[model samples]
Target: MRHAHTVEQVRAAEAELAGQPLMDRAVAGLAATCARLLRERRGRVYGSRVLVLAGSGDNGGDALFAGAALARRGAAVSAVLLSPEKAHRAALAALRATGGQVTTDQNVGLADFARADLILDGIVGIGGRSGLRPAAAPYATAPRTGLLVAVDLPSGVDADTGEVAGAALRADLTVTFGTHKPGLLIDPGAGHAGPVQLVPIGLRPPAAPVQALQHADLAALLPRPGAESDKYRRGVLGVRAGSERYPGAAQLVVAGALHGGAGAVRYLGRPGAEVVRRHPEVLLGDGRVQAWVVGPGSGEATVEALDATLAAEVPVLVDADGLTELARRGPGALAGRTAPTLLTPHTGEAARLLGGAATAERCAAARLRTARELADRYGATVLLKGSTTVVARPDGTARVNPTGTSWLATAGSGDVLAGLAGALLAAGLDPFDAASAAAYLHGLAGRLAAAGGNRLPFGSVHSTVGDRGEAPVTARQVAAALPAAWRNATAPQGGSQQDAAGLGD
Candidate 1:
């Protein structure tokens, strides 16, 4: 059961629970939780201490209640009140009754903070609008500190936008109640919500306003070969990409499509001609294709060929220049078509299509809004690509891809992503699944390509290209790495297939 919720939605759910007659019934449940933590950290130094830095709202109330529980488990417990007179009366009373100390001395608090086994940051939650105020700022994660945990949501993170506010605490583990906020899964705000885990808090967010990707779901949605399947029946991705100027994009996107399980990839365009020259199996021009992958390096994408793509209409992946043209004139020119439309656009193209403010730094909230708005406006699936790629449904279920890797910051990668998405669309997966799986697998592939390298992370990022050298892989390298990446990312029971060893075949 996966759930994604916005801040206001989560807050409303928690508020309703608090209004229940049995609200205090679970106040003592914190002690049981602390005992479990104690069992998990048995042999480590500073294992027994739990610091609760609390504020004034129910968010702070959760920490104080938990602090009392830690005290009962023989761990030294302390609650440092940021707001002197405004702490939750009931929760503070519980902490005091359990012998948890409330200290006023700054030095003593600092010492407790430094030597503390774990820090429970209940300083703020979904209710937080500003940032770490003057009082709560001091305890933010420093270069050296113990594991930090958050309650409900991390302080200084916009639970809706996935944007970090003035000062955010970087948590090692955030134990949130009920469901995950959008910030916990997407970038920027995701940076601060490290390794989030949700605690069942007996309340459900309304409307299911947001969502996140998961591996098993991707695996299930991915196209797989069955009986009576042939190369043509499965799907053919006609790739129109690359040029003399960008000859590499054709190879990389094709590598991606091949690994993506496309039955056949029919190469097209001037770049497609070059791709057929390199890989003799690739056919030139269009034939019968279940999907079309257009605009990889299409600096000179002809209006005639693009029109053929629109006319085919099985499932179309619009990338690079194709994405740019679609953004400007709209895919409405492809009007009166019945096949699904998939548009994969980087941040700039998405911003242009949506006709609004944009930034490489724009939070997930804005991207999500853009995706939904564009899907509705253009009548297609909008895979808005970025550090946190978002795939939205016209039906209101938008999923943020969870698998991300920094090594994916290479050129030509988007083309390969477009290919993978196109193959899935042709193989008959839902638009939402096809786009999200493509983004997730693209990132996983980058990790595999650079698996055992130095600061390069995935592998030798500076290798040479020759008979004796391994070219520093471009997007094609990542696409070539897909099957292996998927194996490493999704192989169950600690086992793997050895069919692939490097980024490329």
Candidate 2:
């Protein structure tokens, strides 16, 4: 698993290492990475133009020290100090000793920024909550050909929540120190931080609040049937989705459930005939099931379905119309329930569940916060689906799905996800594990389907949009690709375990 620590946690860890040369370690890693990139781009670091956008604080100090290193190696390095008065005194002195040029002039900085072979952004650090200040605002829209590398994280993004309030620098790569920050792993901020490189500085943090599961992690969590396993022993999933108005929802949900390692799926809704036609393997009329999937396209019957499903002492997954009904009834409806409850909601649905003073647009901007709130308010595991899907438990611990694609925005996708998650719950995984695992598989399936069934590498970092060479995919195609995704995820790692961890070069 890839762990993401908050700024406070990182600070605490740094405190433990009090007198160590943490800055030196960070500067060495930063300069080395810059040197490698320079060689790759222009054949050598000597005589190459490098620009450092230095602000106040250690973030800027790291950049300045790195600039000094490059200068010693014969690179033409220049520093643009956004805050000259507050810049790190020792770092500035080091840069001057190496003959690196420093200026407080904005126009000169813009000119250097335009022509440099490489740009290191240290205008803001992880603690920056607002957008770029006036002196550095112009760089946000500046046109440049060279690669822009963020020192620790892109400026103006919340370290804890991944929220981008306004203008922020977009980096081609980010060299983060010690550990990955929560902002770099989530959307909005993640979108700005292109690819990340971890540079350890020996700061040991406690338990991470946010985590992303990799291939080995998923492989360990996946439920495999033993030799003595039967249909009943493997686990049966109960599906209460679809209605007369929307029969296709039923077919898609059942399709996803069948491939979720569940032995059998019990269909119980108005669209039973349609579901049976698409999947004759699905048992008609539920008798006994380990878990229940409610909602999807059950328009008018949502109330009845949710009531009946909740009455049973089994793990229940609520989605689509079921989420709407749950929102209407309030969190109190779920009171006194012993079994785990999983709620999957897109941003809009999540906003509704939150009720007072919440809007879809606001929730989208603060995905981590919104998910935690929903999980706490509903007293269940909440999976907030978006460009980055976040699964949060009532205890505030959360996991972000790293495999999501914009191609999954198609209709009926959520229904499919609901079925898959419900099936995993039936297979005996807790709500948190079931939701996280299902999201991982579902996202991988979407990617596979979008790429015309071509098997992509497991745990590869995916953009908000689909990966390169991918085409649009329908919900049915996504469901069809689940088996392929499952196989790839469970495949033996051999020597490619590092690639399976999603650590980029």
Compare the candidates by lDDT and give the number of the best one. Answer: 2
Q: List the residue pairs that clash in candidate 1.
A: 31-69, 252-476, 450-458, 450-459, 451-458
Q: What's the lDDT for all of these models?
A: 0.69, 0.89
Error of 2 at 177 (Å): 0.9
Which portions of model 1 miss their true places by more than 4 Å? 11-47, 103-115, 141-144, 204-207, 302-305, 330-338, 363-365, 452-474, 486-505
lDDT of 1 by residue, 375-460 (tens): 78788888988767878777767888765456566787887788788877777777778898888777667655655321123322
The positional error of residue 215 in candidate 2, measured at the CA in angstroms, is 0.8
Across 1-505, the per-residue lDDT of candidate 2 in tens digits comes to 8889999999999999999999999999999999999999999999999999999999999999999999999999999999999899999999999999999999999999999999999988887785788788899889888999999999877888889888888888899999989898887888888878889899899999999887778888999999999888878999988989989888888888888788899999887877888898999985989999999998999999999999999999999999999999999999979899999999999999999989999999999999999999989999999988999999999999887578888999988898889889999999999999999999888878887864774444364454676788899998889998888778884215434334442
TM per model? 0.84, 0.97
